[model samples]
Target: MSDVILLAPHDDVAVATRDLVPGESVTTGDGESDGNPTVVVVRDRVPRGHKVALRDLPLGSEVRKYGQVIGRTTRPVPAGSQVHVHNLEMPRMPDVPGASDAASDYAYATEHRELPVPEGERPTFLGYRRADGRVGTRNYVAIVTSVNCSASTARFVADQFRGRALAQFPHVDGVVALTHGSGCGLVPTSEGGRTLLRTLRGYAAHPNVGGVLVLGLGCEMLQVDALVAEAGIPADTLVRRLVIQETGGIRATVRAAVAEIEAMLPELDARRREVCDVSDLVLGLNCGGSDGYSGITANPALGVASDLLVAYGARSVLAETPEVYGAEHLLTRRAVSPEVGRRLIDRIAWWREYAAAGGGTLDNNPSPGNKAGGLTTILEKSLGAVAKAGSADLAAVYQYAEPIDTPGLGFMDTPGYDPVSVTGLVAGGATVVVFTTGRGSVLGCKPSPSIKVATNTAMYLRMHEDMDLNAGRIVDGTASLAEVGREIFDLVLAVASGRETVSEELDLGQDEFQPWLLGTVT
Candidate 1:
């Protein structure tokens, strides 16, 4: 076993594969590139999954990892020293001149050509086809709340069918009450209200939801009739509408809602999963509870799967705008057109102002857990996060909760919060979500199934019940990057075909439906 791993030839630091005591000599391991194989004496106690300086660095000198600038030295450091936030700091790089002002130096074309999926390996999964010509991976009965005041009533309605009540309808995945924190307090005509309405309508009209019963309080700013009208719910669609105020209160509303759902059960259960092409799939890429090994293992492997999805003519959506802070430039280079690239850059600028208004900065990331896992700066974290997108050309940029109509890889603007981010992805029409985490993140999106990939073997073994796949084997040499990636792609197809994931087995999606509440609450 090797003691250290160097990701790239020009990297000035190497990652510690295991704990190293001072005065011990370490050699480059098989896990990394073979450029820097010389042994270096340990000058400090370096923990596993952390970085160690391979050479001396002076103050303000840029440190390189993944062949990119992660940060700069805060003070002079000797060889073999452990690199971390205390010794390194994020570099404040000025925005590129005219990059956002116009399409200056924008090529609008690149070497981004699609590769062919092997003829024998073209895959398909069983799915439910909807009236709108969209396909869904899961068949669910959705109870949507029009306002926070009616959330409890909606949940109660869904709860009536909790146990063996839905066993008769095996085709139905589950009865889910999709609730949120905002709906009545905001200005209904404001940007925040419009955004909220868009999200609710998206979920109500989602193909995955076989039947919907919209629950509302009669006096909220957002009216149920308006949402239904804007969402274009057809008369033939299996949908019901009810207001608690009109239904005589919580008990009456729950009874009415249960009766309504019962009437729709047979219709929802009649819909069965049929074979669908890979092109019918739309994958949402997200990462949370990230750690040092995330970039080296799961992220890059997931990137391979993303590229494969793109090759199959499917859509892949990458999100978390703040998390992509420093690495937005790399994505811009892969933009399908100059306009798409500029849209991404503009989103970056918007995030800067957005963060400032909240009395925060983009660099205020890499939470305490991230720092403990050897990630020292948001620049470093962002660089790792972008690996999940692979090298596919970014075809479009979308605002939060906006519809995604493109067929290739695209970017959706979202905050770094996990639930909020996934919520936006689902609203954007992502049929399935693939999330990679180094520290265990057990998460699931209601309408879309989430497949969690673990970055390190240790965490995977510890949380086997919560994780779907072990990507950490790439770092341990048990599997190559492509091998694990293929496994993920296969698992995705299986899950889309009605297979249950860890989070699904635990019944973890209903409480995770969080919409991004943009603007003020009042």
Candidate 2:
């Protein structure tokens, strides 16, 4: 097997497949080797998953990976030297002519290709069909808290349904308490308040939730009645509300909530999973704890599966706005229209200002864990992160927690934080999520199942029980990318058909229900 993987022919760097010592030699080709190869001797001791310069680079020279500009050389570096933060830095956004604005490179829909529908019979999954015409991958009772004051009460109510509490109701997926840190201090009309309300309403109306108990502290700014009114849940859907202050206290509210949930259990359990078309599925795409191999292995494989789902007329949502900073141009070119492309660029612009307000730049990403795993800058990471979206045309772009109304592939503006990102996706109506991680991220989302795909074999094996699938096999050379992608696509149907993910078996998603907090707390 080759010691390095070169993604594109004109790339300036190759990812070290294994640790390399000085004087070690590796060969590069256009990913698929044409008979001829160029050999470069390793000048630095490059660790596995890190980058090796394919040729001599002078100061300010742009470094390319995935055939895109990742960053630029900070100093003159010899070929075969390790290329990383010490020798490379993010390019000034202004210097990169077409990065943020309309330039010749920002052509809209230039790379957009309409997805051709599959010829065979469309695939199906066993799902709970809701009265509202939505299909649910899981049928659960949700205890949604309107304010932080009611969070504990909501959790307590959900806790009552743990263990064998719902054993008799075989179809029920158990109760989940959707709690968060902010709800009351901010003005309801503020961006943060509106975002919190949208997130809460989205979950209450989420197809995965068969019944909901909206809990709140009566004195709080986000009132229970207001949330219920705004949720627009079907009249027949079992939705109840409880106010802690009116109910006397947490104990009383929990008791009332538990009883309400108990009353809704039979109805929820009676909702059987009927055979539903794969088109009814909304798959959320996310990545966390990423490493260098992320872009090469799991991400691309997931992208292929995303493309397959889009071809089937299903919606696949790619989120984590900040993570996609540098690669926005790729998505813009694939936009279905100039307006959709502009919407994406506008979000990117918002992120730049948001970051600046906090005294940081969009390049503040590529977290410590990412750097340790060989990712050097946000540019490199964003290029890799965008792979999860596949090559589908950008159908629509949405604000954080907005309802996902479009069919094909869509983008949701959200923070790069794992739990928060997935929360927005789930709230936006994703029935299932596929999360790719190179450095073992054990994140899960209830109401919606999260399928964790590892980018490298060693981490997958080390954290075998936590991960649902091993895309690492692609990097290991044991399985082709298409095979693993098919495996993921198949697993999505299976999981949607009631198959349990590793996170579900471990009961790991209840606490991961974090709504993105925007604007100010007060």
Candidate 3:
């Protein structure tokens, strides 16, 4: 595809992915005009991955993408005006009581647009099917622990099973240390502590895990046996546990864990990749450090990928609730039913109160960096952030870190914190994650791998070592959305089948485990 032109007909602006010089002639639709469309230099010089207007419009007009209003036109837009925050407003109702009779009727006019799905194609991917009926895109042996006390030992155990030791085991994809801090801190009887242990148990018992070793500092509030008993996990030859206090501290624990892993290695590496059905894939979608162009390019393209995955009977999880603020109504409509939509709406309300309790407002978002990048309000950002899910039917809505039951397209209640948000998705059974960013967030998660998509070409080129795919290629005038979506889908399979992402190679998953803290410490 030589040129990728995106102009939602209602939108008066069109974005140019590459740098266009002053008075440099360019053509648009049908045939070339006698003269170049009058170009207004929005910035000192137009850069790659930025935007340009399609035609002039009156002030207060809207800028559309994904067939939704991302922002409102500010100045009287001239033909080919470089439209941005300086010349736009977030799509918010006039903050006045009954300002205009048409105001109440002004809902998302672009919400009803039909998405064009390519004809006659069976989009599919390579994956693995588990005994529990869950599908996995990756194979991993996880060294999980009940609490922080066993974290170091867990890491020690996984280090002994690195993929390079193929001489001993070849079928194994890799090993990860999945330890967290909640195993012993608070009351074991409290709902929070009990929930924490359950999460740990779920991870250990997850079908994607080829083998699991649960470690604990025996004297901790959460006993290793307590997790297995309550969670109903089977006690099998593959399930092993080491108690540091009983095993004689870290040294003894490490030795015990190593021995157990050595015994399981042969079996863990014996499973090979079989052609699993496409329905076995569950993709997790997230975005970080988003800019104005993020919604227009990277996020939506990823959404296209999400749609493809779901259309093939797989699953897609769109998360980060706080970021979805003003644009939530769009997702609510996609919810499987009114109840599902209402549940999501309720969560948004809770977040508003939650933010206020902390003396913050939802609209107070748009970090300084975001504003500098021409993003004015949370409404504008949400419109962009929501694009990563594509247009699949919303099948379910889950609570933070809650198990992702029932497939197809879904929404998981999660915070906007990248590390925490991603952790929740992984814990909820997502075997792979796709993270899109405009300002560039170097983030990753262990156990389940993440594919980073860069929203701007400059960031992608600068951070090439971190980003796996450049959705910005669409913005740079080099690729099409569908093409990049295919590349991302292929990479998901590669990473799932043993290929490492930038984060995995750099060991970026260790510090990314952050659980959402809903209440205060006493």
Q: What is the TM-score of each candidate against the true structure?
A: 0.96, 0.97, 0.82
Q: Model 1, residue 492: displacement in angstroms?
A: 0.4
Candidate 1 lDDT, tens digit per residue, 416-469? 999999998998889899999988999989979999999999999999999999
Highest TM-score model number: 2
For lDDT, candidate 1 versus 3, the one ahead is 1
Question: Which sections of candidate 1 miss by over 4 Å?
Answer: 29-36, 95-111, 232-236
Alpha carbon deviation, residue 28, candidate 3 (Å): 8.5
With candidate 2 superimposed using the best TM-score fit, by how many Å does residue 50's alpha carbon deviate from the native?
Answer: 0.8
Comparing candidate 1 with candidate 2, which one achieves the higher lDDT? Answer: 2
Over the full model, what C-alpha lDDT does candidate 3 score relative to the true structure? 0.71
lDDT of 2 at 502: 95
Instruction: For model 3, give the 10-residue run with minimal summed lDDT.
Output: 94-103
Q: Candidate 3: lDDT of 392?
A: 70
Minimum summed lDDT over a 10-residue window in model 2 is located at 95-104
lDDT of 3 at 131: 68
The predicted structure with the larger TM-score, 1 or 3, is: 1
